[model samples]
Target chain A: MTEVTLSNVVKRYGKQQAVHGIDLDIQDGEFLVLVGPSGCGKSTTLRMIAGLEDISDGEISIGNRVVNDLPPRERNISMVFQNYALYPHMTVRENLGFTLQIAKQPEAQITRAVNEAAGILGLDELMDRKPAELSGGQRQRVAMGRAIVRQPDVFLFDEPLSNLDAKLRTQMRVEIKKLHQRVGNTIIYVTHDQVEAMTLADRIVLMRDGHIVQVGTPLELFNTPVNTFAATFIGSPPMNLADGVVSDAGTIVLRDSLTIPVPKSARAHVKPGQKVQLGFRADNLMPVGHAVEEKGELVDLELTVALTEPLGTETLLFADLAGLEVQAKMLNPRPVQPGEKLAFHLMLDKTHVFDAASGVALRG
Target chain B: MRRRIPEWFVLLLPAFIVIAAVVLIPLIFSLYSSFTPYKLTRPSTLWRWIGTANYEKILTDVKFWSAFGRTILFLTIALNVELLLGLLIALMVNKVTWGQRTLRTILMFPMMFSPILVGFQFKFIFNDNIGLVNNALQSLGVSNAALPWLVDGNLAMFSIIFAEVWMSTSVFAILILAGLFAIPQDPLEAAKVDGCTPWQTFRHITLPFLMPFIFIAMTIRSLDVARAYDIVQIMTGGGPAGRTELLWTLMSRTGYVDARMGLANAMGYVSILLSIAFTVYFFKKLSAARAELGMGG
Candidate 1:
């Protein structure tokens, strides 16, 4: 087991910087995922840690040793590429045993390690087959097998499941989680899919445009995002943001005829007549007929339904709320049509208020 | 009911007629002439079938056998040296990120010249009295005597081989460079992570992937080199005492200069065996390499 630390690590491609200075501490045996949209420096950060890309400045240490100048082989790391970079000429057995052979291990030891990895990945029948003979899932498994046989200090996955279909990706996700539990190595996975980050990351590092926007547990980021980008990016269907100005009576004036009382928890973060953004998730805003916990202060709004999406047990209602398009959930199974008017309640405790100019969360 | 010919056959009739007139007729005529005692000056001798006489004569001719052996030796050395130099040039050119396109275009300059021109260029360069090589050696005090480049046995052979290699090595380079470009970057990175040194990665991954392309280049070059005439004729003329005599030069002398058409056709048929042998061998190797890379036959 090893702990990986990135201390102000930076990556610059000539005049264009891909990864700005970012610091992170991954505990021993931790499954840290670096995630963001494309060009967000998430993959670049993982590549630097893998020694595939050079760190322009600062230090990256694994097991308390600085590896800034180390080559990928000397860094004692194994990476799984998105395309499942198995040696097309080698059989599954040879692919697994390649690292040991490179290290000049004994034949018996190499064979044993190969067999063990094969057993772990359920590749016993495919030992004699080349990578082209295997299915996408099987090839991905062999890629992991190749990495695990090295038994390196760290495992780096650069969008390894992005090539698989949806069903296989989910299956491989669980298998990777199980592999981490079994092997207990320090793993860093990078992906643009927020769902994968939420499901698989022990601690997620959210990045945006060469900067680390936030780092926290999945639920923490879901419950308390640092800014509007994090708030919308972390959740599916995203959080609905509406422009508003706090009125003299501690109410937010969203439009000419619509005004809402400022959430009590955000009162200290804003002043009267201050411009702010009102944020709420689909789960927190629901139709009046739907059953909610009712623990927080609730406010009602009359919105016209623009669309409805029936998703099995519950339905998603797309409605125009206070001159802003918002998604609200309907717990009760009912048909919703366009132009239909409905009253929905906003759960104030679950909502967020942000500064209009900077997009920073207004937390008291 | 009346039977009718197919429309496709009618459409292909013109091509078949042209091929028969230009290719099939000459091929059959040569094969028939190889069994006769025909001379260019005596047209009546073409109908006299002297079966197996020319073949038997060629089988026992020591001079012809020596020329055949020399042609084989020339092809082997030229092909091998070209392959090695070509691989090196391809690797070096593949590494250049800037001006790579310009460098590739420049690399094809030698290939653009005709083999006859290349032979003449080398012929002057290797000339004993006023040649650039001898002049440079004498000026640099490296050699006092003029080297007999085209007269001596080994020197004549070396001069011809040098010209052949210089003119054709770029074929291998271009094809192998295409192979290098087709290699995926993922496996190289994976090899790096799997603890393979640069050399190990190249040996295990890069070379294996390039085998098919290499063999293809080898096959084409072998066929081209087997018909080695224009360069050898211009540079050495198979000369002083037939020291650099190859099959094509010897055959041309026998066929055209001496006007013994039937004997030359026999020699031609024999030399065609060499080309076929090399082609078959290289094709077998190509298919084997492709199969090893999991590309099905």
Candidate 2:
């Protein structure tokens, strides 16, 4: 396996700049994920890596070779597209052996390679069947099998599981992860789903509007988000932000007359009377008890319970707080009717402080 | 719920009636006439059921059989050549990124010109003395001898085939180009990643996908070739000792020029079998191709 490096890579579509200069170094055999919202240039970056698109500026090197001018075939990279682009005409065996046949490998070698791949993917029985005969999951397996048979230097997946249903997507995601472990090849997966990125990636590259925002492990990005975007993007029930002003005592005052203690690390960058934003994840806010009330600010919020979604042992509470909607996942299966007002306590030390103008997180 | 008649049937009634009157009636009438001594000049002869007399004559006549065999040969050669030329043209056009639309329209220029016009153009070009081809050859001193382009049997057939291919090959090109456009790009990309060479991708993925369209064009052109007229009529008129006599030309001479409508109806019936055979074969191939592509009906 060889590491991939992009040095100041840029992509342009006519007059429009789709991807701004992006520099990244992907380690050998690393499962690197590029995650972002739609139109964020994530797929474009992956396509450029696969050599499907030409880089408008800078260089891309694969396996220590400058692959800027190389076509996809010469790049030694195999791609699994979102739509599992199996040949409609060829059977599974033919599809798997297509590359070998094209390379003019002997017939015995082609059959052996195809059979081996099929066995690994549990596709041996379906080898004689064409793509139309296979179900979605089987087709996905075939697509993966098609890639695995190549044994290329790198595998590029452009949202390969996006077309499958939720149950199938989860199953295939696990299968893909297992495949990666078995093959030990460098993989660059691009997707908009944060959960997929968090679960599958060795290093997550978060992007917004064609620019890389942060690159780190899942937990690192979750706990140490550089800005409000990363902080809000990573969590399940995203981190909530409230407009607040720093009081003279160095605590931030919320709209509903609630005050949260700001950490000491934020005190130097932010001062009293300055506008700030209070950020906290859903898990940090809890129902207050008499004993734990001595630790931080105990400000109560009267929230209208808008909806209650129960998932086995936990219940998700969606409520309106100070005119902003917020969700909290409580572990107990508490019956919360819509329109019911509940008083909840906000944890002070667990909260984050952001500069109101720039959205940069004030760190401790 | 009460089952109401489909509104589509109401919308379809007019077309159905028009088709019945314009197409079905004529087709059935002609089929019936094939068994009778139908004469265009004398309408009364249409009802005279001569019952196999005309068929027997056509079956036994050496001239009729020769023309029949010659027509099949002409159709086979002309269609294959046209299909090959059309495929090559389409492949080239598919490669053209710039001015593709303009090139497509220009390629259709030959097809837009009537077969009769193409026949005349080629006829004059192949004329022995003052034609462009002969003049070019004579001026270049390639050959002092004047070639009889329209006299020799092989040359006559070649010239006619050339005219036929020139006039109709675009039919294949345009249809196959539409097929090429409809093919999904994913498989091609997948093939590239699969390390398939350009030729392998074309042979395995591209050609098989295009087979249905090729067969469809072939089927349509087969019938068109069997009933070949216009160009052959204008160019040679099945002359030079009947060297280039196709079924249509021979049948035309019998029915219209010589006014032997009874025997011509028999010849027409026999030629219909050729069209039926070709249409059936290509249609079967089309179905197989569709099945292969998993687009079953």
Question: What CA RMSD would you report for each candidate?
Answer: 1.7, 3.9
Pull out the clashing pairs in model 2.
none
Q: How does candidate 2 score on lDDT? A: 0.87
CA lDDT, candidate 1, residue B296: 80
Write one digit per residue (lDDT tens) for candidate 1, span B109-226: 9999988899999999999998999999999999999999998999999999999999999999999999999999999999998998889989988999999999999999999999
Best prediction by TM-score: 1
Candidate 2 lDDT by residue in tens digits, A1-364:
5999999999999999999999999999999999999899999999898888899998999989999888788989889988999998889998888878777889999889889989888997899998999999999899988888788999999999999899999998999999999999999999999999999999999999889999999898888788899989897888988889999887788777766677656777788988888888877654433123336655566678798888877677787867777776566566778898777776656677898889988876
The 10-residue segment of model 2 chain A with minimum total lDDT is: A285-294
Please list all clashing residue pairs in model 1, or write none if there are none.
none
Q: Which regions of candidate 1 deviate over 4 angstroms?
A: B1-5
What TM-score does model 1 achieve against the real structure? 0.97
Rate residue B250 of model 1 by lDDT. Answer: 97
